[model samples]
Target: MNPGASQEPAQPTPGKHARHPKAGSISQPLLFAASTYALGQVANFLFQLRLLYLLGPSQYGETGLAHLLLVTLIFLADLGYSSLFLRESGNSPDWQHTWRYALGHRLAATTVLLAASALGWQLWGSEGASQEYLLWAAPACLLALFNYSSPMIAEGRRLAGLLVTQVAWPAALLFWYLLQDSLAQSMAATAGLSVSLGYLVQALVNVFCSRQLKLWLPLVGKGQIGAAVHLSLIGICGTLHDRLTPFLLAPLAPTFLPFFLILNHVLSGLSGIQAQLARLLLPTANTAPGQARILTVASLLLWGTATVLLAGLLIKDLALFTGQRPWLGLAAIVIFAWGISASSGVLATLLISARLEGRLMRLLVIGMTDSALLQIGAAWAGDAGYLLWARMAGVLAILVWQLKLLKLRFGLAGLTTLALSLLACVADATDWAMTIGTVLLLPILIGLLRQAPCYLPARRAGAHP
Candidate 1:
C-alpha cells in the first residue's frame, strides 16, 4: 500500500466499517461561561432597576442620552478595527505585533477623546443639562477606554476584567447612591465616581498583568503606526452598530428616548454575554477540535430561539412598550438580530482563523453601506420603529452576503425561523398564542430532525448524531 494510505485498518467484515479515531471533548468552559453570564444578567438588571427607580423618568432620560452619546463616542474613538486586530492575534499567537499596534491606536484615540471632552467643557461650561452630571462623566470616558484592553487579556489567557469590574462598579455606585438627597443627584454623582473608580481598578490590574507577561511596552516603534491605522480601520466596522445608536436616537422624540436607551442597555448586557462567547471561541477554535463549526450552528439556533421567544413575550406586555405598538417593526428587529448571529461566522471566526482581511473587509464594506442606507430609511419612517426596520433590513443583507462568502447552507430550521420571525414582525399576534404556536412548530421543524449532515457526525440508524 502507498505510505499515505497505509494507515487504513485491516479489511472489515461485511456490513461493518472501520471506526475512525475521534477527537476528545470537554465542555467545562462553555458551562462556566453560560452560568456566569446568566448570573451576571440577573445582577445587572437589579442594579439598573435600582437606578431607574431612584432617578425617575426625566433625569433618567437625560442621563440615558448622555450615556448613549458616551457609548457612541467611545465606539468612534475605537475606530472600527479592534475586532480584526483581536481576531488576528487570537488566530495566530505569533503575530506578536498585533497587540502593540492595537494598543497604540487605542491610546492615541483615547487621548484625543479626553482633549475633545475637555474643550467641550471649557466652551459650554455647564450651559446645557449635561453639566450637573459633569463630575460623573469625565471618569466614565477613561474607564471605557481602559475596559477595551480587557479583550487583550480575554483572548490571551481567557482572563477578563469585566466580571470583576461588573460587580465592583455597581457596589461602588450603590455606595454613592446611599448619600444623596433625591434620586437624580444621587444617580448623577454615583455614575461619575463609580465609572472613574471602576476604570481605575481595571487599568491598575491590567498594568500588573502586563508586567507579568513581561510586555516591553516601550519597544513599539514607528513601523507600528501604519499597522495601527490598518487595524484601527477594521475596528471601525466592528463597532459601527454601537457608534450609530446616538445618531439614530438624537433626532427622535426626546420623551421616548430614555425607554429606548434602557431597552438598548438591556440588549447590550445580553449581547455582552454573547460577545464573551464569541471572544472565547474565536481564540480557542485554533487548538480545539470542531469548535468553529459547532458554534456557528449553535449560534443560529440559540439566537433564533431567543429572539423569537423574547419578542413573543414582550410584544403584548404593556410595560415594555412606552407608547404605540410597533409590533411588526419590533419583530423585524428580532429576526435581524437572529440572522446576524448566523452571519457572524464569516464576519468573525472564519475570517479570523483564515487571517484574511481582504474578504472580511470587502464583506464589511458592503454591510456598512446597507447600514447607512437603512439609517436613511429609518430617518424617513420617523420613529424608533423605522430605525428598527432599517436595522433589520441591514442585518439580513449582511446575512445573505456573509453566507455567500462562506458557501454555507442553512437547513429547514434556520429558514423556518427566519420566515416566522418575518411574519411575526409584519403581523400582530397575541403573546401566549404565538408562544404555543412557535413552541409546537419550532421543535417539529428543527428539534426533531436534528440534522447537520455537512458538519456534525452521522446519525446511527434512527437516532440523531
Candidate 2:
C-alpha cells in the first residue's frame, strides 16, 4: 500500500450524498484555479488585441470562424462525459479505474466524431480560402482529445489542473505569436499552428500533472460507454444552444461575427468568477447545502459588482475596438445575462452534485431547445442588435427555469435577497441610476452580509467554534 494511503482518510463508499473534501482542505487549489482563470483571461484579451492589430477585422474573422468550428467539433466530441466522470469519481476509492474509464470513453468518442467531421469535410467541402483555413484548423480536434482529459481528472480531484492546462495553452499561443512575428505570415496558418501547438503543450502538462497526482489510465467497462454517450448528447445540445447565434450569423452576417466573438469572449472573461465559485462549491453542494448556498449568493454579489465596474471602465475601449456603439447594449445584456446565468449555474452544480443530473439534463434540453429556436428567429431578422437581444432573452428563460428549480429545492426565502440584488444591478447600468439604486439597495446588501453566518454550516463541537 502507498505510505500516504493509511494517513489519509479512507474513501467513503459512494452513496446518494458522498462525502466531500472540506473547503479549508482544498483552499489552495481553489485559489490557484481562480488566479489562473483571471490571468488566462488577461492573456487572451491581450492576444485578441494583438491579433486585431496584426490581422485586421477581415482576417481575424476568418481565424474566428476556424476556431469556432474547431470548438464546436470538440464540444460535440465531449458528450458530457467529463462532468459525468467528475460526479461519479467524486469520492470513489479506485482512482486508477475511474480515471481510465473516463479517459477511454472520452478518447473513443472524440476519435469517432473527429473522423466523421473530416470525412464530411472531404465529401462536401468548401473551396479556396475557407477550405484552406479549415484544413489547417482541423488538427486542433485531435489535440483537443488530449487537452480535455487532463482537466477532467484535475476537476475530479478538485486540484489546480485547470490552472496548469487552461492557462498554459493561451500563454503558449501568445508566445508562439510573438516568436513568429505573425504579422507577416498568413493569419490563418499562424492561428491554426499556434492553437494546435498550444494544445499539444497543454496535453503534455496535463499528463504530467495527472501522473504526479497518481492517476493512471486503465481499461474501460462496457457500462461506462452507454452512460457517457447519453450524457454527451445532452452536453452537445447545451453547447449548440450557446453557440447558436454565432453559427447562424457566420453564414448570414459574416461581418458581424468577429465583433460578436470578441464581445462573447469579454463576457466569458467576466463570468470567470462564477466559474471559479462553481468549481469551489461543486464538492460541497450536496454535502453542505447551506454553506454552498451562502457562497453562491456571495459570489453573485461580487460578480455583479465587478461586472458594473469592468463594464464602465472598458465600455469606451470596447466600442473603439469593435467600432460599434451598439456593442454597449450588447455588453450590458451580456453582463446581466452572465449575472443571472451564474446564479443558475450554482443551482445546477448543486443539483448535479446531488445526483440529480438526469432532471437537470431534461431541463437543459427543454431550455436550450427554446433558446436555439428563439436565436434562429432573431438571426433571420438580420440585425446584430436584435440577435444579441434574442440571445439575452434565451439566457433569461434558462435563468428563470433554474431559479424555479432552486425555489423548489431550497425555498423562496433564501433567494429573496438574491432577487433584490439582481434587480439593483439591472438598474445600475448608468451612473445616475446606479447611484440611486445603490442608495436604495445598501440596506439589503448590509443585512444579507450580516446574516451570512446563518447560511454557513454550523461549527462542530471542539472545533473552530
The weakest ten consecutive residues by lDDT in model 1 span: 9-18
Q: Estimate, for each residue in 28-105, the C-alpha lDDT of model 1 and write its tens digit.
A: 665365345545455445645655676776666655655555555666665444454454434556444555555556
Candidate 1 global TM-score = 0.72
**Per-residue lDDT of 359-438 in model 2, one digit per residue for the tens?**
66778788878877887888788776567667667766876675455442222323444454345434434546445444
Q: What is the TM-score of each candidate against the true structure?
A: 0.72, 0.72
lDDT at 355, model 2: 53
What's each prediction's clash count?
A: 10, 3
Q: How far off is model 1, as Cα RMSD? A: 8.1
